[model samples]
Target: MFISLNVKFDLFYSILAPNVIPDGFVDGRQVTEKLLEATQLDKNLYQCGNTKVFFKAGTLAHLEDLRDDKLNGIISLFQAEIRGYLMRKQYKKLQDQRVALTLMQRNIRKYLVLRNWPWWRLYTKVKPMLNIARQEEEMKKAAEELAKLKEEFEKLEKLKKELEEQNVTVLQQKNDLFLQLQTEQDSLADAEEKISKLVLQRGDMEQRIKELEERLADEEDQAANLNEVKKKMSSEIEELKKDVEDLESSLQKAEQEKQTKDNQIRTLQAEMAQQDETIGKLNKDKKNLEEQNKRTQEALQAEEDKVNHLNKLKAKLESTLDEVSLWTKWIFFNIFHSLL
Candidate 1:
């Protein structure tokens, strides 16, 4: 009797999956580690060494079974892809065969059933020419429609170009308007600053006017005091005149009894003249103060007018700024709406 023995090789190497090993990797220990890490196999079944792996008695068998399953799964995936492609090819062939068979059946039925009829035979003989004429007419109509479509397309293209140009112009205008708005805003800020400065100046002017008025009041008080002093001097002059008259009467009655009487009279007259000169100077000073007060009032009036003018100017500028802002808003709204 002859006996044949079949032996399977590689109990340990078979456990490494083909997909786990990189190209040019030949080290057994690295391959074992990669396979173990990739597969996450139970550590109790195998031990890793410096250059080899030791497996328990049944571990090699189990790993080989797992490798076989993985290989089978890859084979099955390839088989499914090939089978799907073949099935699609076969389905297309079957569809063509079915259409050809249907066409042949229709032709056989027509030949067997209608071949003997005179009208059918005549129609068959004339059908090609009639079909040709009809196709020619349809072709003519199609050509006319195509020409019309070409003309319409050209018109649409021209219109699109014109619209694009208009849009560009509108965008340019919008940019110009935006720049104008920015300039207006800058001007408005400057105007506000000027107005603020004017307001502060107005306050200063008012304060100065107030100070002038107070000074004028003080001058009036000093003039009243001078008038009182003048009145006291006039009373003393009247008393001195009366005393001179009495002394003259006594000199006449005593006839040269008081020889110094003439000297006292002369002194009294000189004092009167000095008092008159002082009165004249006081009147001139009062006139000067009156003129100064008048000038001060005129200056205050001018300042008030200046303040009024500045207020009017500020209002006008504010109105203009408001109008510009409104116009800018309108332009922005219109531009945005048209773009949308």
Candidate 2:
């Protein structure tokens, strides 16, 4: 077919080779590599000449030259080419056009069925709503996760507060235990001092009892000597006999006083024995307290509940010690009264 000297042969070549023109009758001769090369060369030459036409090198834009040609001449040449091709094909082009038209109609029907156009139009209309629903679901899941994290954080904070309270309670308990221990130690010291005083009092009472015994022995010796003197003077004179009788009465009185003193000594010994028993009991109690103190020291590192129990035990022990101290004092007073 005839073509304009300046037609975009390269454009036809580039498009037809990629099958973009669909049913166009393009062939190897019309879209040759040589034709494309010539078209690119002409564009570059025209560009170098600085012509008024705007065309890119290495492309079919060289066809801009056809725009300067007479419009009637182009139409006449295009018609002549069409008439020559149609004369040779007779009605074959029409038949081919009819077939192509039928194929296009069938393809259009298949596309409509496959795409489901009515449903596609509905989908296009509701797509934003579906997207919004999906976004809402994602937002809900994120909110749930955030809430769960916040709950966990609150639990951790509560646990931290509980631990702080426990720490404060433990410190308070430790201080209380320290004060109680100091008080108990002071009480123990006082008890020991009292016990020492009791021991000194016991020694003084024993010494006094020894001196009284010695005096009683000396009085007995003097009474024996007077009895010998009375025997010697018995038949000497009535004066001497009267004198002996007086001395005998005095001796009898001295014997009665010695017996009374002996009774008092026995009573004092009994009181001393009671004092010893009391001291022994006190010593036992002190030992028990020492053991309990040792246990308390051992349990210093134990739990608060155990420390509280120990505190109660200490109070009971203190009460018992106070009772024991009162008993000891009463016993000491009675012993001293008897000695006096």
Candidate 3:
């Protein structure tokens, strides 16, 4: 987000009054603060150059890396968005200064015309000159005001960049969440397979225990031996049940993780949808601003034509005023000589 205030200051001063040039430095920091005041943007969010302000400089540069990743024009969109915003800011600042300068010129012309009044009292004649001086002061004030406005314009521009970057950041987060959800789902599927195998093993153990019980019932004469066999089988059955329990616990944990992932995915989806809405609104605003810029350009061009006409008229008036002063001075000289 960079703004360039490239006014021809030298030409401006020469046109206003050849011998007078206003002295001041363009306080980039003060201008930046003023531009961001309404937006409440932090100073760290941007950097100010002599005529340019850059926003999210590092982030913007990082985005260029996406060009080879086939992310499909998103990076370009961000660039164009910022560029358009800068252009709009520039146009607005120019429009404001143009209006102020036009008004000032008109006021100066009024003073000049009044100063030419041939029958006015000495005090009355002096008053117009004083007013002219005052108007010059007002012109200086107007320049200062223009600088403030330029900064204010930057505030809006900074907000625009922040909003767009936020949308991009949200999208990146959503993609990461989606990948996590996929991994959780795959883990859940593996857990389900392990649980199915455990259930089949438990069924096999139950069948073996039933067979051992029938054998012991049929061989009471070898009751001690059968008792030993039943004890051994029971131990094996207990071990299988423990294995099944562990598998069940593992399955439950996997299911819990899957549920958590699903919840996160849903939440991120909601945020992405909201961001989409915001981006849409911003796109609309961009269109409106473009239209406004077109109109402003046309208006500015018309104003330039009017200013040229006025300047030509002013030149002729100044020439006539110079001739009138010479005639007045010559007549006074002749009268003084006659009296002597």
Clash count, candidate 2: 0
Question: Candidate 3, after superposition: displacement of residue 61 in Å?
Answer: 34
Tens-place lDDT per residue, model 3, 85-182, is 99999999999999999999998998787776765434453344434445455546555555555565556566656666765776676556445544
TM-score of candidate 1 to 2 decimals: 0.30
- Candidate 3 whole-model C-alpha lDDT, 0 to 1: 0.57
Q: Which residue runs of candidate 3 sit more than 4 Å off their true CA positions? A: 1-159, 187-225, 289-305, 320-340
Give candidate 2 misplaced runs (Cα > 4 Å). Answer: 1-138, 224-340
Candidates, ranked, lDDT: 3, 1, 2
Candidate 2 lDDT over residue span 1-340, tens digit each: 1233223344544432343332322332334434444434553333221111223553333344433343556689999999999887978888899999999999999877767676775454444443444545654655555555556555555555555555555545544543443344345445445545545554564565456556556666778766555444333334434544555555555555545545554554454455455545555555655555555444433434444554565465556556656766897999999999
lDDT of 3 at 99: 100
Clashes by residue pair, model 2: none
Task: Judging by TM-score against the true structure, name the best candidate.
Answer: 3
lDDT of 1 by residue, 192-295 (tens): 45545545554564565456556556666778766665555556555655655554454354433223444443444454455455545555555655555555
True-vs-predicted CA distance for residue 3, candidate 1, Å: 97
Between candidates 1 and 2, which one is better according to lDDT?
1
